[model samples]
Target: MNLALWIAAGLLAAVALAGGITKTFVPKEKLARANGGGWTATASVGFVKTLGVLEILAAVGLILPAVLGIAPALVPVTAVCWVLLMIGAMITHLRHNEAKFIVLNLFYLALAAFVAWGRLGPEPF
Candidate 1:
């Protein structure tokens, strides 16, 4: 279970980190174009960048605390945050009628939830 949690956390962190880097650095117009003028089309650049920064922070929070043995409780907290983020993403995608993105968001949500449950219940660190 410990290994499973670590793997899930690592995978989620990698995805969040990659997404954060892209959303943080990529221009809104290009991001919209890349997504077929989807959510980014309606969102402001500042809002999009803010989400990116949040994702980056969540990614770091997922790993660093546990690895450093400092405030390891933050691992579950970060997972909870990721779960919330995915819920928001699902809502946004639903509003836009983007079923595909919602499915992807569900996948991420499930992974985050697993990590949260594992860390909070069975695996302390």
Candidate 2:
């Protein structure tokens, strides 16, 4: 991988890994409070756990294929999936009027787009 691809991949890996860890282990009460704090939501733990799992899966799909040189196709697929995931996050936060998390979602969307675009063409140095 060239500098651009490597950087994009690294960013995706970092974000997904961090978010996954956060969702997987963050305390339920704390997470619920941080999750916009309303609506008597009992299933937040489930959402967080599910998000963690998907993030981990996306992380693997993002790089393992390119590294192994077996199914490079997975790289772009993973990038697109992450972009969609972030878009969903953006919409969700917007609906909830959570400005803070919405901003974070935007960052993820941009980064995911960068990864998707960067991975498409030749590896740039």
Candidate 3:
């Protein structure tokens, strides 16, 4: 169970890190184009960058505390943060009529929720 949780956390971290880097460094026009336009069209660059920063922080929160065995309890807290972010993502996607992205958002939501539950339960780091 510990191994599984670590793997799940690692995967989530990697995805969040990648997302953060893209949103922070990539040009808005390119990101908008890549995301099918409708989404970023309604969002400001600052807002996107803010989300990116949150993602990067959450990614780090998920790993560092647990790995260092310092405040390992933060792992579940980070997972909860990811869950909230995914909920917001789902709402935003739905509002923009982006059904495709919502599915992925839901998947991420579930994964985050699982990590939250797992860490808070038997597999806590």
Candidate 2 local lDDT, 10-106, one digit each (tens): 7788889887877788776776677557311455677768888899888888778888887887887788999999888877777667788888878
Whole-structure CA lDDT of model 3: 0.89
lDDT of 1 by residue, 36-116 (tens): 989999999999999999999989999999999999999999999999999999999999989999999999999999999
Each model's lDDT comes to 0.94, 0.77, 0.89
Ranking by TM-score: 1, 3, 2
Between prediction 1 and prediction 3, the one with superior lDDT is 1
Q: Which stretches of candidate 2 lie over 4 Å from their true place?
A: 34-43
State the weakest 10-residue window (summed lDDT) of model 3: 33-42
Residue 18 Cα positional deviation in candidate 2, in Å, after optimal superposition: 1.3
TM-score of each: 0.98, 0.81, 0.95
Clashing pairs in 1: none
Could you tell me the TM-score of candidate 2?
A: 0.81
lDDT (Cα, tens digit) per residue for candidate 3, span 1-125: 88888888898999899999988989888999887787786789999899989999989998999989999999999999999999999999999999998999898888888889999997765
Q: How close is candidate 3 to the true structure, as a TM-score?
A: 0.95
